[model samples]
Target: MKRILLINPWIEDVSAYDYWLKPLGLLYISSALKTLGVEPVLVDCLDRYDSDLLSYSSGSGEKYFGTGKFVETVVPKPDCIASIPRRFKRFGFPEEVFRSKLQQLDHVDGVFVTSMMTYWHYGVSDTIRVVRQELPSIPIVLGGVYATLLPEHAKRNAGADLVCPGTGMKPIEKALLFLGINKSVQPDWFDELSPDYSAYESPHYAVVITSLGCPFRCVYCASSYLWRHFLRRDPTKTAEHIEYLVKSSNLSDIVFFDDAILVGGGFKTLMKEIEHRSIRTRFHLPNGVHARFVDRETADLMYANNFKTIKIGLETSDRALQTSTGGKVFLNDIYRAVDNLSKAGFTYKEISAYIMLNLPGQSEEDVLDSLRICEELGLSPTLNEFTPIPGTLQWKELIERGSFAEDIDPLLLDNSIIPHWWKQGFSLDTVQRLKEAAWSLRRKLSGE
Candidate 1:
């Protein structure tokens, strides 16, 4: 059988955490490759449960709910951000471990690398560079959010023989064709294929998306740009996949990675299916759900289904800011949603509110007011620093407004680093203060 080696590259950033992060797209591609009769081998650098990695880290244990820090090694900051004072680090398995894994593989047909944030392209390029050194003759393909968002940049810098942009099986098919394999994937692959979690030896958590894309066009979000239309899987099929994961793997957590999981009421149906199947597992919704859709029934369903972590997208409590940013939610929506969740037996610890900071034209008071509202509603506050995505409406608007040059380095767009460079928004000290405020509020809510 023809073999393709799949790699999830290291994350070179100031900081990163494995908040139930999984290469779901790559796993799906692995399944697709299998269906096409191609053998797919995986080398996931971020797999915290990787036995080799565990041994390398001296058997460090994971934190609560299988979410914990990646093994980090401090690295020099890129020249563009050298002025920034924070220490830049590569967060994942050591380079030696990755190289050792590559050396063990025998005669792979090609290599496929997946990327995450657009700013993390440095990691992608470095990963491909190493792959080239190891297997000089083998072709390498790059695909994922970074490549899709900035294809030309990836082609120029990522060092891949072929860069497949966009989503779904089409990108995987493109990669296969580049390898001279002419095979078409099934049309219903989205629903038919499950992420090949068998790639991991023993994952603590498995992330599953019941839907693709978002229905709302939030200014700062790229979900609408990434996927033009919204689509959902059969809830029964989704439940079946969950049951399979529970039965086949030693998984303690199931995370939903959908951008808008609660839009069409399919989540409720899926909850009922899980209940019907009697599959007991700790579920989490780290992705911010639309508060407008969080009715009493939905809250009850989430509670009955044992959702351990629920995050509601309450971007800002300011009325104008709420309407300007796609109007997907409002202050009243947040109020009602919290009430429903609290009535459904979810306490402040189980529920959290996503309060965005550093939004264009937003004031410090706006963020403080949002935090105050979270406190009043008895919900933990999570401060999400706003990073203007490349193709989103917000990015374009900022460029047009002359916030920064159109061709600014994507790495400077990192939220932690943006405050240092993006002068139109918050200063580095102000951002620090805002983070401290959020932390204080969280402590207060937790009764610390």
Candidate 2:
């Protein structure tokens, strides 16, 4: 049997949190290679339970349903963002620890590296470098969002033997074939194979990708650029996975990582199956759901099925901006969704509206108005800062206006630096005041 190694690269960013985050794509690939009779060794740099890492942990302690911060080491800022006033850090295992882990592997035929945010490519590049230093002759393949969105940049910067773009398990199979190990079996959909979460230490919560690719292409989003087409997994199969998880362990929560979970009627069917199975796991839709899809039936089903957290994408209240920015949602859609959710016995505090800020031409008042609309509708507000992604419409506009450099380092793309670093149309004071107002409203609603 061919031996294959898979790695989850560390994240080099100002800050990062583990909100039930897991590399589902990489796990799925692991499942595929194992089924093809390849011996797979999985190494996650961000593994929280690593005995060596835990010894060095600062005793931050996990909080709130197994979701908390990742222990990070402060590193020097990259030259491109040297002027920015925030400390850069690597949010995973230390260099020596990672190298020691690599040294333990033997005669690996191929290595697969996974990436996350575009700005966090520094981690991916560093991981590839260390892998090359440790295993010089093995072929390395890089894949994930950063590779898919900015393939040319990754090719030029990320020192990998090959870079595979987009979704699916074909890249892993292809890499195995390169090593002269071929599986002459009938092809099946990538989503059909269950992700191998058993590879990790027991996890308290799991992430489920019931669907992929959103139909609406928001100007600031890279969903369309990354996924080939919209796809949804079989509802019964998804329920079976959830049931297996609950039965195998004390799994109490699940976070839906779908870009759009309710695009089709699949959510309703999945809920029905879960209800039939009597599985009592709490569900969270951290990725914003489409407001237009929330009807009386779906809303009630979600409430009945124990969806504790629901966040809706209400980008802006400006009608023209709404129409221009992909027309995904509007003021009326927000009102209707909120009404339906309230009727389903969900409290206002349970449902939050994501109001986007810091667009190229977006003003402070525009964002403030959206917050006001959400407040009027008795919904809590979450301020989502706009980060210019490589292939998006807003990215091109920022580049044309000379506000962003043609060869800008991806580190500057962090969303938290919006008001602090970039002054597109709003001043620092305006941004500060608007943020304060939003938080103030949230506190008042929660009676904190």
Candidate 3:
């Protein structure tokens, strides 16, 4: 059988955390490759539970609910952001460990590497460099969010033999074809396949996507752009998959990574199925859900199904800004949703609201007002620092209006680094103040 090596690269950034971070796309691709009669060898750099990693670190870094910090090593800053006064670090397995893993692997036909954030392209490039050094003759392929959003940049910089830049099985098929494998991937692979978690041993949590793509076209979001249409799996089948994970893997926590999980009524049905099966495990919705969909029934279902983390997307409380940016939620919708969640027995600690900072045309007062609303509703506030996505409407508007050069380094667009260079948005001092305010509110809500 043909063997293919799959790699989840290290995240090179100023800071990184493992909030149940699973390479869902890579795992799905692994499953697809398996269905095509290929063997997949996984080298998940972020797998904290790997025995080799545990031996290297001398212990695990796990904190509460399978969410914690990644093992980090300080590295030299890239010339583009070298002047930024923060330490640039690579967060994942040590370099020697990665090299050791690669050396131990048996003969493989090709190597596939997956990437995440666009700003993390440096990580992708570095990963591909190491792969090339270790296996000089093997073909390397790169695909993921970064590759899809910045195909040209990835092609120029990522150093992949072939850069497949699309979603679903199309990219996988392309990679397979590039390797002379004549397998046609099914279009309905999203519904037919589950992320291959078998590669992980003793994982604290698992992430499942009930649906792909978002129906709402928020200017700042890339979900609608990445996925052309919203596709949902059979709720019953999804629940069965969850049950299998719970029973087979002994997983206690399951996270929903859907961009718009609650857009349709499917989430409610899925929750009902989980309840019917009496699958006793914690559920988390770290991705913000639409406030308009959090009706009493939905909130009740979430609470009944043991949802431990519930975050509502209340990007901004400004009425005009709300309408201007997708109009997905308004003040009253937030109020009603919070009321329903509260009535359903969710406490302030279990619920939170996402408030965006540094958005174009947004003032400091707008963000402060949104935080005040979260305070009034007794929900913790999660201040999301804005990062300009390349293909979004906001990105095009920024480029057209000369906010920054179109060929600007993607690293400068990172939320942590944007304030230092981008003058159009809030300055570094102002962003610091806003973060402090949000942190204070979270501390208050947590009774700290």
The pairs that clash in candidate 2 are none
Q: Candidate 3 residues 1-448, lDDT tens each?
A: 9999999998998989899899999999888988999999999989888888888896668887788778889999999987778999998899999999999989999999999999999989998899999999999999999999999999999999999998888888889999999898777887789999998877879999999998899999999999999888989889999999999999989999999998876888999999999999999999999898899999999999999999899999888888888899999999999999999999887899999988888899999999999999999999898888999999999889888898888988887765645557788789899999999999998889
Model 2: residue 234 alpha-carbon error in angstroms:
0.9
By TM-score rank, best first, the candidates go 3, 1, 2
lDDT, candidate 2, 264-342, per-residue tens: 7799999999899998888889888999999989999998889888999987888888889899987777889999999
- Greater lDDT among 2 and 3 belongs to 3
TM-score of 1: 0.98
Q: After superposition, how far is residue 87 of candidate 3 from its true place, in Å?
A: 1.0
lDDT of each: 0.90, 0.82, 0.91
Stretches of candidate 1 off by over 4 Å are none
Q: How would you order the candidates by lDDT, starting with the best?
A: 3, 1, 2
Off by over 4 Å in 3: none
The C-alpha TM-scores of every prediction are 0.98, 0.94, 0.98
The Cα RMSD of model 2 versus the native structure comes to 2.0
lDDT of 1 by residue, 327-367 (tens): 99988888899999999999988999998888987899999
User: Number of backbone collisions per candidate, in order?
Assistant: 0, 0, 0
Off by over 4 Å in 2: 58-60, 183-187, 418-423
